[model samples]
Target: MPLRAEGLGKTFRSARGAAVRALDGIDLSIAPGEFVSILGPSGCGKSTLLAILAGLDKATQGAAVVGGKPVTAPLVDAGVMFQRDLLLDWHTCEDNILMQFKMRGQPTAPHRDRARELLALVGMESAAQRYPRELSGGMRQRVAICRALVHEPPLLFLDEPFGALDALTRENLNTELAALTAHSGATVVFVTHGIDEAVFLGDRAVVMSARPGRIIADVRIDLPHPRGAHIRELPEFTAYTARLRKLLAHDGRPDHREGVRP
Candidate 1:
């Protein structure tokens, strides 16, 4: 597994020092190069889980490991893309991508070429010199995606990366992202609230319940790879969407399906 969480749990402290459990007893694993999308209702600890796995935050209980190493701090081999682009307004797209190296105390020279290659890979080479302010929301997302992969990490975690884009742009980026994840050869743990997007992009969609979050099910996407927009029209895709919605709606309850559905 590229990523693994055993007996995972997390709790937050309020002003009055009350324990607010965000995640509980979560056990999940992702294989190398596998694209796993996490879907759930609001406050399910979906992003919280991603943050813990990326070592941006610590789990109050259990462990999260990436590439056989326990996640204590941010690991060099894992990359994370949050909801916002978080790109500096001053730098051009290329420099913003290269910033990944600079922030890590790494020499940018070695990673500059890779950054260009990734921008080109995402069809953003032309925007290399353009600042974040010069880019559209969708364009910024493309740049963000390239920046995340510039380091060539083996594992990537994303949290609602496309929630802000328009429908058409979001769909286009979904196509682009699906292709990117496949070609990057990196295991991806994507967190999204969109049921259709989850089924469309994930090899397996992990559905979680509400607060005190726990994995309710792992639904395999039976569709083929290199999937295009038309894939969502397929029976399997729609079926998975419906199933996930059903799961999220009835979450924190019994296993209505009786077992995990492939």
Candidate 2:
């Protein structure tokens, strides 16, 4: 489904009763089946924007529309993944994914085969019976992805899902995610601080400014799909990353730039 944010703005009151603006005059449209990466400074409201788009939170002003309807509540057809795995410690890996179905009052048995297939896609099939406590950080995140995807939602939101992993693991999962989503025909909005990651995963990398975030640049990534790790070595990939870094550096404050590096 396509997503549209019209004149979107968000404001929050601080503990001392001060109004803090997070997003302002943000107008964005994401086409169906498009993977758009939102890159911005640390406090630039990236996560807040994702929340509004996913209908998890309401915009202080304007509206968030999905398909042809205005979003007023959490979308039943949307799936969300966060930096933390948020898996149940007592549940096994496969069970964690099945929990998604159970939460919706759906039958888990019908989805079991697909859940195993997703685990196999992430090379976690052997770990299906392993508890979250027994799995590594990356493994847990893999299960999180499966859980988010098992429902076959047309839209997926990921908020720095790989941000907490080690360098090598992060890269590996990035590649896997690219490959996994290539043919799934799902529209994805990925929010991240990593410039390379934004370039690597996004069809278009939308750069946002600091606090009271507004989009400053939207650069289309020209690289081919089904991108592997080797795609990162391409000159085009480097150029996209470089351009994003420069955009962030020019639009972001010195302290904010620290969170935007590759």
lDDT of 2 by residue, 172-221 (tens): 89998888778788999999988888999999999999998999999999
The model with the greatest TM-score is: 2
TM-score between candidate 1 and the true structure: 0.92
True lDDT of residue 26, candidate 2: 90
lDDT of 2: 0.92
RMSD of each: 4.1, 4.4
Error (Å) of candidate 2 at residue 102 is 0.6
lDDT of each: 0.88, 0.92
The residue pairs that clash in candidate 1, if any, are none
Off by over 4 Å in 1: 254-262
TM-score of each: 0.92, 0.95
Q: For residues 1-262, what per-residue lDDT tens digits would candidate 1 score against the true structure?
A: 4889999999999999999999999999888889999988888898889999988899999999888889999776777888898989989888999988888898998877788888887778888888999888888999999988888788888999999889888888888888877888889999997888898899999999888899989988889989789998898887888888888889867766788677
Q: Show where candidate 2 strays beyond 4 Å.
A: 252-262
